[model samples]
Target: MISHRAPDSLSTWRAAILIAVIALLVSCGKPPPKEISTLDKIRTTGVITLGIRETSVPFSYLDDAQQQAGYAWEIANRVATAVKRDLKLDTLAIHTFVVTPQTRIPLVANQTVDLECSSTTHDRERERQVGFSSSFYLTGPRMLVRRDSPVRDWSDLRGKRAVVSSGTTAELALRKLDRERGLDIEIMLAKDIGENFMTVETGRAAASVQDDVILYSNIARARDPSAWQVVGAPLMREAYACMLRKGDVPFKRLVDATIAEMARSGELMQLYTKYFASSLAVKGGVRIDQPLSDDMRELLRQPNDRID
Candidate 1:
């Protein structure tokens, strides 16, 4: 026969039992975080929601009637076609969601969009929140100014205000520039590129900072391309990639493969040629739509490459 424990000992033992029960309940109460399934979701949905910028022309933007059109849109269409094949569906609705750099990942996390085809940079901080595709286009950061603006370089922004896109790498670049040169310039953020250009055009802001390629593309697509100018030198080299939810390996792999296939087939080149080759009206000089540079060309060559 076992003897009974002292009162204090019994109390301690009882508390231990209570703690274990509480722990068990806590473990069982909450459900695990939802796992991201790359294949099944696409198969069942029969649609791919693509995140695109509404006004970033030559990459992803609206046409005259405000319908989606551009190089990035073309890429999205091809990816949608492949997804349709996987689902055995004849036609999949290519739903387009307008997103900014700041909102892109949050939308993906919430399943508001299947993939982001907008101009997005892959950074360690961003990777912690979402997965990134291989670099689709690589370029350097540059500035946009009116034809008669006084700003010659990034340093010229000191004691001046520069317009930047809200929640973009451009804004971050400007911040870094501010710190390095100890410039006291103020940075203003615009809701979109259209407004950003307007900031400089109206003389409200001295210049606009952006990716060199995007600034060039914008100038190429402008109504009167000669009215504005892309000024200054490249401040930083950037590699733009498509963004997806973190941990969705299969979907990322499939997209990488599709991009590679397009590159190999020369379809990517054709798409770029179709949309970005024409130069829009401008002021200072004729802004020729340059051919795909070496960095972008290399990006096109790497099919199925993943970003770690």
Candidate 2:
């Protein structure tokens, strides 16, 4: 005959304590999960986040389908492929986050976006906050005005309301010019390229100061392309490159390698022609019609991260 009884409270508590101790011992025996680097995080999660622009036409923007599509968008995809290959990923998911000029750097700095390939300029000031891949495009600030507008150059902007995208190099350049030349220009700040152009279109501002390529692309996509024109010599040349988190050497190496490969194989030129020289299939067959420049050819020949 066998008799069964519940264990005493003290005995049961002891048993629970023993189990807790065993768990602690086992946990201590194993090393803590390795800290996740950007690459490692992407590898483990199978997703890479890309920072893109919504209205930076010909560089990064939305198509008629509202999907991200542009020259920089294509290059970002190539880098994604390289990341996938490097990680030996069977399938890597791409997640895009729309970024404005004001938020692009902060998002990248925080690693919320793994790569930003848009119209961002690479300069010493920005370099302190993020790492830039090889320079992919060269452009400079110019004025966009109505075809009949008298603003033929920067000097004409005096005492006029000129608009620029907030948090862009163009803004800084314009402000500096306003001060040095004493143009007394009333500068209006817009959130993005589209808004900047709209300020001029609506007659709220006399001119929109932006990168020359962007101005050209905007005119091409305008309702009446002939109504707008890009004027004035380029303010100062700027280089556009892919942005990653600061100190992300491995990822930067991969991005730089992919861009360099594209340059050497003439793929970059082909992409340039597709976006700048040819009429886009979207947005009613808009064509930028801007030809490649000597600086761009040189950059293609020797891809680099030189800041201007």
Candidate 3:
């Protein structure tokens, strides 16, 4: 049988072939990967996939018929309308995708959804991975406790455990507070807001830390409002925005512009009032004042500012 390797000449030939293969791979023109913008995708598909929360109460939740409707849902529908107009589509279909706190970012990044109008916390760390719309809502961290619980403020939880939703900005804010303030409070994470608040409900944890908006909305959903109380001073101010994939500059611009237009025309305030304000005050005794954050003012002036 002929020798598999023809001595040094065969070895040289194999080495050359390997180098050529690598060069071919390096120089391969594979369409430079498909980098489609949200706007482009909308135009191409004639559909907008909006990611919403499944159990976020007034933000985005299922009704009796299990259809999506809430403040976030309405806002997303408005944006979808603007998107359809921008793309000059005959009638762009709006698709709803339920997302939890943990899956929102991944869904946006993977293009499973075009825009995420869920109750997502806007932060610098998250901005690295996904784009955020102009801040339409400004909120802070708050604690929910039993009506009879002695914990009235943020400082009362020295040794007690504070429950928060897992993989959420509330948990991150609590951890940061723990390190910065040297607070010895044990931070516990629940799978969701309902679970986090359940800790307080069952008296298993001293308190539950979460977004003030979410807390108020959840309280409104509760069958017994007198059983639990949202306690303590605001721990941290966080902004909420519509999230999209990062590097979609065109998409980001369009989203920003849409928000600015809404703010300029006072439509955003109306949405907030219609969904969040009166409901909270009348039902939960929480009055969310207007122009809560600087973003509100800036958005009023320039609604399309790039938050990321």
Best candidate (score: lDDT): 2
Model 2 quality (TM-score):
0.81
lDDT of 2 by residue, 18-102 (tens): 9999999996896663433678879888999999888777889888888778999999999999999999999999999999877
- TM-score for each of the candidates: 0.75, 0.81, 0.78
Range of the 10 consecutive residues with the lowest summed lDDT in candidate 2: 30-39
Which candidate model has the greater lDDT, 1 or 2? Answer: 2
Model 2: residue 218 alpha-carbon error in angstroms: 1.7
- Runs in model 2 with CA error above 4 Å? 1-36
Tens digit per residue, CA lDDT, model 1, 171-208: 88889989889998898999977787777767798887
Off by over 4 Å in 3: 1-34, 278-308
By lDDT: ranked, best first: 2, 1, 3
Report the lDDT tens digits of candidate 3 across residue range 1-308.
Answer: 99866688978989999999999998685545456688877888888999987666566776555667666677778788888887888989888787877788989988999999867777888878788886666677888777888899877887789899887777877888888878799888898777877776777889889887767666666668668677776677676788988888877777777777787788877776666656432333433332244644555455542433
How big is the positional error of residue 191 in model 2, measured in Å on the Cα after superposition? 3.6
Rate residue 259 of model 3 by lDDT. Answer: 77
Winner on TM-score (2 vs 3): 2
lDDT per prediction? Answer: 0.75, 0.89, 0.75
Q: Could you tell me the C-alpha RMSD of candidate 2 in Å?
A: 11.4
